[model samples]
Target: MIDNGDDSLIFAPENGKTAEKVQEEYWKVLIVDDEPDVHSTTKLVLEDFSFEDKGLKFISAYSAKEAMEILNNQKDIAVILLDVVMESNSAGLQLAKIIRNEMGNRFSRIILRTGQPGEAPEKKVIAEYDINDYKNKAELTSQQLYTSMFSALRSYRDLKIINKNSEGLKQIINSTANLFQRQNVEQLAQGVLTQVVSILGLENSYYVSTSGFTAAQTSDSDFRIIAATGRFTKCIGTKVEDCTPIPADIVPYLQEAISKEKSGFIDTHYVGYFPTMKDKIHLLFIEDCSKDLGPEIENLLTIFNHNAGIAFDNVILNKEIHDTQIDIIYHLGEVVENRSKETAYHVKRVSEYTYTLAREMGFSEEESQLFKMASPMHDIGKIGIADSILLKPERLDHDELNIMRTHTEIGYNMLKSSSRPLLQTSAVIARDHHEYWDGSGYPRGLKGEDIHPAARIVCLADVYDALGSKRVYKEAWKEEDVLTFVRENRGKMFDPKVVDALFTAYERISRIKERFKDPE
Candidate 1:
């Protein structure tokens, strides 16, 4: 250890590695004294001084104007040794004002070194200017200078750490705010990866892997690259070991973190483990972080991991609730179908057909899933119709038929009062699914675009399923017969665009029919 007086010490590397192989980071010090001897003497005395595994890198400026230029270019200068009597008697004072006010650099510790103490007295300069310390060149000995440098460097280091932590906290807040807007697990996972990287300042060369099971049960089959940035973008959705050009040892490190349920660091790479509430595991891998993995950064990672896991858990819980609601809707629709002497598969087949047609019509995956969930409820109004009219063995008379048509209005009234989106959509399908493209065929006869697009798509899907399935009043029609009816009714009974989408997805629709065949 090299002593800098007053018991302060700087320890050397224990491994005794060559200087060239072990690159040393340094604390930057700017010496802004007009006297050439002061600059040279200060560098000579502090040449061997080191602190916190770093040495001092002295930058020289012969005048205040030159110092300002250097300060403008370099951002990480830790301490400034400024001389009061520069080109002008008050040039150092003026530079201090510019640095604090104009440059907004409040972290770098400034020590005013002056030969003429009377020009700028120590008491007056300390109170008026933002300088941290004042020293007389005549009395400033080698040991005193080392002591002052040590104090200033320590203050600068602490200030920098506080600033970095503040920025990291801001990043975490912003990331979680953005994450709250995501509606699904995949989106939340991606947002968590992005925010973690932002907090750690690792924008480049990172990979995120996830296991859809508990750590104890996690295997290669359960692990997938959920979110990847930079060079690993192509690895998403693939197994970790299957990704090419990956480090051979990364998988083992990831496994260790998962099985142990903890974060791990190996050299410059860090693996963060976040166990979600669903008993699943998410691992974030980053290579070549912009900063060292110090105790402060490690603490920040721990906090981030905890919060991210909770956010992911909330998203998963919401998704499970949403899926359960959809299942309940399907079962309710099945009840209505069974009451009408229709097979339970009629509702399932209608849902599948509507999903296919919605996708073919360029609807987003989420919207298509909504259509699939809402379409099954289309005939729920039929449950309110009189049994004599709904389960009739022969064609209905005009009055009975009119009463039967009111099932659409009955179903709409039943669901329209609810505030849920799925039910609101079901209300629309119930109210307008029977309305025709050309001002005909409904209780209200809402024509053209006046009908909701969701109802329009489900209308064709329901009719297709109904005509192809056996009913109490009629036998199931042939595939060609149903197709001919759909073609004939285009623009007259159904939306022309919806009919076109149906024809486009004819093969997939056939496959759906074969898959969910009615019980014989």
Candidate 2:
């Protein structure tokens, strides 16, 4: 549309001829010739030219210096109609070097049009420089110019596509890696939306899924936005019908994809369909697509979407497995606690405290979680003790106390045969949770570093909780007294580091008792 510099000139299609409608996209053509008449004549010849349903946008520069300014500002110029001997005998030839090497634009096609063939021979120009085609000014015709443009524009278009897709594939591979690191379905859904936006080079995206994990209903109306990016961030948790930013008409097509369980490009937008194993559905929506955006993106999205669905399903299934395992451990612990009329929440409180203390000591979350799970079964051996010894109202005599201590060995035997890591961990915890740090007090009398770190951590957590809780024979000690006792027995009764961690995290870990409180 812009024809020249400083002076303005506009061209319109002739009225009698069947004209091409104005296209949204244009192939930029830069005309670099110092002669004013040459600029005028070249525009007249290529004035009606169109390539790939797009018209030409001509940029005029009178010298090599002026052309450099235009090239510096505009990045997507498709063709340069360069003239030799502009400012010098080899101005156009040198400009070609700048365009290829200094400017670093490899996609733009350059065709040399020179009046002085003697100044720069066609053979030498084509062989030395990166120029695509060389034309003698006297023999160049209107039809020849058109033919040259068709070849140049098509090559530029294809080069750009190959580069864009290569970059897009790199983004998808990294995005899929990020998706796998997410710990929950919500995080994976958000990751899917982010990666899709990055691949498509769009700014906005959102994920929609059924509200319940076990979705019994399937309809466009049932989908709610689970995650979103950009201006749509506030739309999360909103029903698709209520989200105003989303085009309302796109809903039916989304339902169609979900109904058919397919993911592909729609008429204008990219629709992502993810059906989870829990009978749930997740859909990703990318907005404001380009005319060139189509099946080219489908291949990249297919690889990324496949990983997204698997990641979401894995998180959901792993969470279900963890929940079921925790339920069984608590039920079994609660059984042992009831035999001696202990607080049902006692096992839960100690479990929370053990997790808090282990993490405070710089343990990994995975290791700390194992401690949380294993702490509930620490008193499991008490199940083997007689009610007369286990439930005695008063302090047990020496013989009766020794019988009670055998319960730890009994619990160890109960779980020691299992091959599972969790059960084997629980067996060690049940056996050593009662051991003293100084090699003086336990069925095993294990000393110092000889105790398993998990058992050492639970030992401190168990006694700290027991001292603060009320028993049938002894009243509950105050917080001040409990702290004083733990501080004084730092190495005598507990692992010194675990004792220190408990004190450092006393405010946070002590609150666990308040949360999982003994029921009145």
Candidate 3:
């Protein structure tokens, strides 16, 4: 009963009985023998047999060459019944070795049957090849044939189960290593969801959603959906109950999984609970899995959840440290501004302006944040100037102005020694922010592209804020006067590209000024 690559089912007729309808999935049996009578007789005997609610499907091949072709094309052939004497006396034995050693197929059960046992001795053949059983055709009665087949099928089934478990474990191990490479919580959660579907071999059959919240928050409303895939893509950033058209029963199970701090399964669906350090809890939901959740899959999920918990904790801790560093940068910049009789909000305005210009210049979100953090330190060099020159109410002479110009180099020297990334960026901004676009400004006299773009952006932001805000030696200028000066100095005092970005983001620039205005 070989499949001819057509969408039709073929079954051998039993004696005086109509063949039963075949199950959707059946155990495949391949018969490799030179005799036509043996193939017909074997199929006739097993046509009515069923095991584990699955019927038998037989495939026939007359020669060993044809048998190898069938084996190459089909993947799930469970048992192969090979005859000892075929085209040659040793053909069956040779094919058995090829299947196990060369093809690397250890899951299929092979049984050797022969009419002439003297041609190939039983004990020698069994020891030499990887066959599962040896039987003499004369003594193989109907009951003996049934017994032999039942035992072989049982062994084949168990081997498949073991193989599936080994593959699942391998996937989980690889996924854990990949998940650890992500640096933030949102990225880690997305990776975990992708790996869980991959481990089950149901990547396209299931939809995954993950929600996270602080552990102290008990209400379901606090659990925001941080990541969602497939049908739940639009559910991201929404609370669980607010996800419209989601099954009502699934919402309660998600809440239960979080409240109880455990995983829950309903038929093919599952919810995994992971609690991290610092009172953070993550919940993963998988829906519409095409297959039943076996004990093996459940066990794999348990191991995956445990490892993911540690990775999630590391991401949260790293985020906290990052926020603390940014705060330190803001305060250090404010201290320098305060010494020059400038309000703290002046530094805040510059940071926002730099961030806006960076975005307009096509910088990524991460790079824009770096610009915002480093821009505040552009005037840190002013700290080194003495009060006699820095605080003078009148214009400075040549010697005193030259001393004021040395602050750029002084700020660079103060911060250049630090190994931290944020401080290193601040050092560059401090040194080059005073450089002119046309090789006229002091320090390095870096012209055009020689200066870093971050420094170029901060240069405009600093001048704009200083012109608008009142200082110790001058009154605040009108908004029109500042814009006119910026436009007039486009390619001489500042980079033309930076000036263009400033105009493009002028609305946001105005909003930042109003939001952080100094106290009256």
Candidate 4:
């Protein structure tokens, strides 16, 4: 496919000498004529040919089979001079179709030629097959062939630039669309590295910072690495200055990018400067000494960084909103806990438990965050209950118990009016968390799979956290006893799948419990 990813018009690196190979690269031309005389004559005519300062390098193919082999191995062949009657009358035309359709070689320009004009397809058929030019062997003088080669190489160069621009734009759009999918700054940083390396036509790149998404013209400590990939994975949380002896020293490039406030290549490494709305530059540094950078690649990188700068602003704003939302949920959960004289960590432990279980059950990381954020509001309806009912030190009378159960419905009513996803989720959990797997639960008495999966997960999480903590009517149960009861009640009081997820992640659950324990 001619490596049209804005990589050089020449060959890619082989044997780890990419820089050297690119420095001495030529415009590769393949001669697919059966006659040895045609090969010798073509090479002789173009032996001194240089288009845009790149001389022609000839590859000979005596048959279509050999041509296909050369095309498959050589990704950067710029021009194919094909004979229409090499293997068959339509062999050259068929090869052109395969190159364009099956092999996806859009960047290479195909020129068809034949000694016998009557045996060749018409000009219309040749154009249909995407052959750039048709030439009769007798009429193609050296001057005429030179003119054709000049036009073909120019077209090839334009196509490579256009392909690079389109691919870069696509990557920018994809990266911006994925901003909401990132769970943290570290993930966002990693995504930037992956996308940039792809757009720049390189194999691998790594490193991004959380604390110092700052402009490169600052202190070296400002660049504390948060996300690291490729060979730099071990550098996470380390400063760029501290990343010495790793082969590429990026501190200088970082400074250069921010000073220019533009994306550019320095000593073959690509350094991008993305300034946010806050008047700070969030630098992206990548090491690729192999790629041949031209004005087309530089322009593409500039266009991408413009979009990436905006993405940086959006990601930061989104992160702030996410943190604020979680804080509000925690505080709200604490209010309900305080009213019932329970430890604030009750809600904390429950949220983490739901998150852990959701992940262990194969829910995505984003879905698991929703579980963590909304589970704390499971008891939000208790805010409407009388203190006498909520904080009762003794078993409630049947009428009082029935009133206590109404807290679920009250909580649902409080949050169900809001259109937000988190609140809507909280409403579902508040109403249905008491519902059981065996159709023997409260409020609407919804059973089994009829319960919302979020609520079902919350139901099990609530029971587990509550059982292990001291309350007005009960002392904290032993951890072993808690596990036994949970397992025994599976498919009865709790969802069996959720219970199983807990067992599968017992050590993690235990750690969450210990981290948020009530003060002795």
Report the C-alpha lDDT of model 1 over 1-520, residue by residue, as the tens digit.
2335754333233333213212368889999987766765676667778888788788889888999999999988999999888888899999999999999999999999888999999989999999999988766777778889999998998898888788767767777778877887667767766776665552222333322211211453466777777767777777777777467777786777877888757566667787776677777777665445577667777877777778778887898998899889888998898788887698889899898999999999989988889888898899899888888999999999989989999999999999988889999898889988987868787899998889899889889888988889899999899999999999999999999999988899989999999878
TM agreement with the true structure for every prediction: 0.79, 0.71, 0.79, 0.81
**What are the per-residue Cα lDDT tens digits for candidate 3 across 1-520?**
3222452223333234335447897889999998876777777667777777788888989998999999999878889999878889888988999899988889889989888999889999988889999888766665566777889889998897787777777778888899888878778878887887666553322433432221222353567677767767777777766777467787687778877889757556667788877676788878765446567777888888888888888788888898888788788888787777786598889999999999998999889988999888887888999989888878889999999998888889989999987888899999999888998876988999998889989999999999998888889999999999999999998999889999999999999999999999
Residue runs of model 2 more than 4 Å from their true location after superposition: 1-24, 33-37, 61-72, 84-98, 101-104, 118-120, 202-224, 230-254, 264-271, 285-292, 324-342, 354-460, 470-475, 478-480, 483-511
Which candidate achieves the best TM-score against the true structure?
Answer: 4
Better of 2 and 4 by TM-score: 4
Predict model 3's lDDT versus the native.
0.81
Better of 2 and 3 by TM-score: 3
lDDT of 4 at 223: 65
Instruction: Give the Cα lDDT of each candidate.
Output: 0.80, 0.80, 0.81, 0.78
lDDT of 2 by residue, 1-520 (tens): 1234433333334334233336777888898988776666666757688776688877889999999999999988899989999878889989999999999989999989887899998778888999888887766666677788899999998998887677767777788788888877777778787777666652112232211111112353587777877556677777777777666787776777877888776776667888888787888866555435556676777888888888888988988998899999999999998887886688998899999999999999989999999889999999999999888899999999999999899999999999988899999999999888988878799999999999999888888878888876687799899989988988988889999898899888857878888877
Which scores greater on lDDT, model 2 or model 4? 2
C-alpha root-mean-square deviation, each candidate: 6.3, 7.1, 6.0, 8.0
